[model samples]
Every structure is written in structure tokens, then in C-alpha cells.
Target: MRIIKAAVLVAAGAMLSWTPARADTVPEFRGNDTGGIIAYELAHRVDARQLAVDHCASYGKVAKFLAVDAQYGGYVSFACRWVPYGASNQPLRTLY
Candidate 1:
């Protein structure tokens, strides 16, 4: 009986740990413009940069992705810099 109880407890603990937490709010990309650069945060690096560029478009500016990072649980932060029309810019590269 003790062995069965211990096994059940372990299984219960495992199930609980495996369950994902319910997020109260939806995760969203956030951004800000600083010195002609759009800084952003999101769950994924690619999406973060896209968001920054989109934001720059809203401000009537063209952007090129600069730096990105995704180190903690899909939480990413990135920056986009303005580029002149017809000028080439480096592709987006995630640091991690």
C-alpha cells in the first residue's frame, strides 16, 4: 500500500509539473523608437524584428533589423535602424 501511494504521489507531481500555466494576458510584441532606432520585444526574434519594422512603417520610415535576442522562454528583444531608400541593409540576425 505504501509503494502504491508513493507511486501515485509521484505521478501526480509529474502531471502537475508538466501542465503549462494559464497566461492571463496574451503575449504581445512591444517596441519603442530611440535615436532613429526602433527597439522591440516579443516571444520570437523574427517576429520581434518584423514588429519593429512594421512600427517604423507606421511612422513613415523604412527600417533594417539590427540586433535580436531570445534567451528567456521565447522572450526576445531587438532593434531596427532606419535605412535610406535604395540603400542596402544587413539581414536580421538573432544573437541567441
Candidate 2:
């Protein structure tokens, strides 16, 4: 019985984590940025820090990824063409 209860709880927790959470408020950034958001969402599933550092300019060039189209869920997100949120609010605007 205990094992079954634990499994049920675990399954519920997993489902909750997978459930998508929309933002309650949107930012004022009006740009057609989609690369970062797309990459972030995809990158999030797997641990690809090294790939992000080498491929993602925002990760290395900028410092933070300004999420223009961010999706909320069990975690926070950032997806922008050029906005700094990491590395103490610094960005690599020159790349974009």
C-alpha cells in the first residue's frame, strides 16, 4: 500500500512538472524574437550547458537571455533577441 501511494504521488508530481504554465503578465518587449525562446525550451529538457556556451551567443556573448517569448511552468524562463538577465545584467547585443 505504501509503495502504491508513493508511486501515485511521484506520478502526480511528474505530471505537475510537465504541465505548462502561462505567464500572468506579459512584458513590454515588442520584437520578433524566437530563437532563444525556442532553443531554451528545447535545451531545458536536456542538460546542455556546454552546447549553450558554444552555440548560444546569449549564453556566452551576452550573459543573459532576455526571453521575448517566455513560457512559465515548474521553472522560470527567458527568451529574447537581446536582453541581459544573467552575468549581473549584461548582454551581447553586438551578436544580434
Candidate 3:
């Protein structure tokens, strides 16, 4: 029947036009030797900080928090600085 064929076409069109929703829950790091920025959701702040620390560690430095922006989900700015004497390059871990 023409009605059935029209219904099928409409369904197919809708299916073709469907788009999946996107939530940026993953932390993204962008930095260089001097400093870097991390974009992430609030729930992923810890992950972002850890990523910064790891990146700075690669350069034999430590990560220092500079600023935070809550717009566009969230962002954390950090600078890589030399590790002072008697200071550990590793981030402090809490045992729960």
C-alpha cells in the first residue's frame, strides 16, 4: 500500500537524520614546557590534575595550579616549575 511505503520512507529519513548526543567527559590536556591548559568536566577535575602532573613530570618538573575557568564545562590552567629541594615531583595520593 502507498501508506505503508510512505511510512517506511519517513522512518528511513528520520533514522538517517538522527544524531547522537555528545558529552565531553574526557579530560583534554594542551601544554608545553612553560605551562598548559586542561579542559574537562567538573567530575573529571582529578583526572585533569593528574594528567597535568604527569605531563610536567616528563619534563622533570612539577605542576602548579594557576587558575580555573568554569565556563565551557571546565578548564584548569597550570604551570610547570622546577622541583625545589626536599620536594617530591609525584602528586600526593590519598588512601581511602
Which is the leading candidate under TM-score? 3
2 versus 3: better lDDT goes to = 3
Each prediction's number of clashing residue pairs: 0, 7, 0
lDDT of 1 by residue, 1-96 (tens): 999999999999999999887875545555565313322333333554455556666555555554444444333444445556676753343333
- How accurate locally, in lDDT, is each candidate? 0.53, 0.43, 0.75
Model 2 Cα lDDT, one tens digit per residue, 1-96: 999999999999999999777666443222233322233354566543333333345343432344333453322234334444554754432321
Candidate 2 achieves a global lDDT of 0.43
Per-residue lDDT tens digits for candidate 3, residues 41-96, read: 64264577677778787777788999998777667899998878886545443332
What does the lDDT read for residue 74 in candidate 3?
Answer: 69
| Sequence-dependent TM-score of model 1 | 0.35
Question: How do these models rank on TM-score, best leading?
Answer: 3, 1, 2
Error of 2 at 42 (Å): 28
Best by lDDT: 3
Error of 1 at 82 (Å): 4.0
Query: Which stretches of model 1 miss by more than 4 angstroms?
Result: 1-28, 35-41, 73-75, 78-80, 83-96
